[model samples]
Target: MTAVVDSAKRHTLQALLSLPSGIVRRLAGRPVEIEGNILDPEMQLVLTLRKIEGAAIEERPIPGGRRALVDAAKAVGGDLPIGAVTDLDIDGPGGPLRLRFYTPRNLAAVSPALFFIHGGGFIYGDLESHDAMCRFLAERAGVRVVAVNYRLAPESPFPAAVDDVEAAYSFVTANATGLGIDPDRIAVGGDSAGGNLAAVLAQRATRAQVGAPPVFQLLIYPAVDFAVKRPSRTTFATGFFLNKRFTDLTEASYPPAGVDLTDPLLSPIYGDLTGLPPTYVVTAGFDPLRDEGDDYAEKLRQAGVAVQHVREPGLIHSFANMVGVGRSGPEAMGRAAAALRRAVSTP
Candidate 1:
């Protein structure tokens, strides 16, 4: 029954993707250009489809929100093929941690790996929501991927997610041989809130906290600082998919009431940027969080860290999970995967 459902889902996705670009553009209507940045047409098409569903952030409950996100990811990504997947239980700061390891076909005996974290504003997502992304990166970048199911907020708020990821990093580096990864070549990365955690973990690594530092860091439209309000926040606040209302909900819940937003744990932009590993920072030109991600990349450069920044003007946040749709999202993500492959591969 599960297989049949999965097959049907993939078939639908293929049908959607097989539509001609001319027809997609026709359905998407006029392009959305904000501040000289044009939105990706394929992305616009998805937005058009979403407009029909018309679900508002205020009406979304946590459990339902989580299920919806996972379902949407599966619909688009559909458990893309991979050589191997191994589910492992590791010691976390809070009891046992669940991790899914991905290995691509024809990989080396031991290869570089990515410690991937999923994004959900620190309140929702888990390993299931990002399974397709993990498979995409592992298969495309030719690296092993370990996707962590870290603790979420409102249940284990503030530093709980941080503690678990830090502990997981230590375990991965210590047991590198057993996990079929090269310890020295491990990288850390994530999308959105997960990207925030990755940045925080990299900073801790500089302080000799999370084993050896990650060789590279990939942050996709990461939420770096919650303290300041950039113009983009208001400019693209509504109708761009990730709106201010939803962000407000996440902010209200992730940190305990009366907690400081500027604290480095919640916002890594306020922390010292020295001694960090090489990094690739991605920002969506139409995203509300654009300015902050751009700012973080500049700070990394000034701190003397090797940094690569890409602003996909036509793209929006969550492009990392957009493999099943139009050309632009996959094109943007492919560039990141290429960068990851370079970062992990032996010189």
Candidate 2:
């Protein structure tokens, strides 16, 4: 029965995660070793358990696949409880959008805010998937964190996610007074596909010449170039958690056939980076997305944008979501939150 198979799978994963870290490292099998950077032992330990669990980023039947990924993320690195969390719905281009606000226990009269997008290669994640990460950011950074439940791909492909992010940002900025936020101190951020959306939204704001555009962009291993394959795309493709198959599936679902993948709205790395907000980009050394994230940060810097780029030499992609795996993941993410707090706390 389907239920039996699902239950068996759950038990198997639980068993794997319970093994000794050394055994887990051996069980993680082998990846195509790349030159220049070694895998972080801590990350390797967690990833080994994941491999044993057989948690590939493949599409299942609709909601099932989505639920599976969300459960896996929660199982490994469940959220830290926050002081104050609330949910509200806003009008999005597609329909009503859901947003979760994470506020610290000791609330400030007016706080800087980060408009967050949850990453599941544009298909898997939801507000719940990233509940813990958002809470961590709010508590650690001393800022209000709003996580967006934007429409997913295949059904709400291409500009749908972009539209939702823009609408969400606009709503927050417009209602800053009521929301107890400083309009000029808002930033935009996300990881993976959500990071792609954040970059595009910042571009849109810059082009529109909005007076109160995002003051900072927290891009955690952003997928900036969708059309062409960068060197790292091939170098670290498989066994990296975020493999090529997932990337191919996400591309097919969102862009549709014949859509120009090079469009600035879709691939913001190709967009003019001049005059955008101060940007903080985080890249994992072993991720397929490493090179492009680094490239985008350099482009931003060259364009005279204040840029801070951090590279975790031993980690894989999506390390930000693996906070429970090791101290490195949490430490790296906390550094990003600190950077964001500093950027948004100014004028």
Candidate 3:
């Protein structure tokens, strides 16, 4: 890794360690208040607190309040050489969606393509926030990467983002010839809420009978369900980077009101996983959503979908995003990139 990246990782880890444990714990176990104004005073306070913490951690806000906290993570090791970046905007269900394409310099043609979705729950995050990581993946996996800028919540709502994702996928598949990509070598992947969307998209594509389904899915500490409770929800719900309070706030920001939490489209863990693509699920040891990710993977397995689950010990939720900060951050990304490469290389 580059010296700059090494510094970033160190900075990120220090900031995370400095977070008030009590506040993290309280934030984790906080319950969602689905009544009255969506932006209730308490909700606003929680948002404010989150912003404060984010600022302390050097988090950068994307178009929405969706912030990517790893941008400022001090790199702790040598930087890995990367490649070229090209930006484009594709038509979506609502309008046009922004996309960033990354290709390493020495990569070969007919390489696998990874459609990346960034995590910020459903509220914040964009292509810029995850720029380095996407480039890292393209370089490390020796594949092309297309990172989607899906719509955010509180405005776009549940299905809106999902619709945009599907539209983006369709556009990519339909225009694969022009893009010089192999339609049969496509995979979808994401972290946190993005992971949830990746899972949902696999199901959506299979059900809709769209072009060939994605060959594999890479889910990193994904938030898969909003209805059924998991053990992590209680054990690691409080103190950590992602807390219960933030989850509730983000959930509120998405649906606003009157949306069924159990809707398969909303909470994909409750959705049918049958006939979906093969999957690789990554979970954090101390994350509240760990069990949900595990459960979702198991559901896919039981439904006959090929699946593999990897649990990172001593890691917390959202750690992968900290690639610019903690030692484990880039390590996780490297592992994920290798996994994607293996998935794409397999016949």
Error at 327, model 3, angstroms: 3.3
- Give lDDT tens digits, candidate 1, residues 1-347: 75576567656655765689887777678978877877777778777766665464335788787776776666666657899998999888889999889999999999999999899888878888888888889989999999889998778988899988888888888899888999889999999999999999899887887778789999999998989989989998988878898789888878888888899888999999998989999999988989999999999999999999999988877778877555676788899999999988873
User: What are the per-residue Cα lDDT tens digits for candidate 2 across 1-347?
Assistant: 65465455445655665577677556655533567777866667566666666546584666777887777766545547678999999988988999889898787888889889988888889987788788888888889998899999888888888888888888888899799888878899999988999899888887774325788999999998888888998988787788888888888888878988899889999998999999999999999989999999999999999999999898888788765444667889999989988998777
Off by over 4 Å in 3: 1-80
Off by over 4 Å in 1: 1-13, 54-58
Name model 2 segments beyond 4 Å from true.
1-33, 209-211
Candidate 3 lDDT over 1-347, as tens digits, reads 45465465455444643356555345434433321212122222223335554343313333423322433322222244567788888777888888888878787665778888888777767776677667777887888988899988767888888888887888888877577678888899888989988888877777875555888898999888887777777766664567777776776677657878888778888888888887889887767898899888888899999898887755667666554433456777788888888998854
> Candidate 1 has which clashing residue pairs, if any?
none
Which candidate tops TM-score? Answer: 1
In model 2, the worst 10-residue window by lDDT is 5-14
Q: lDDT per prediction? A: 0.85, 0.82, 0.71
lDDT-wise, the better of 1 and 2 is: 1
Backbone clash pairs for candidate 2 read 79-132
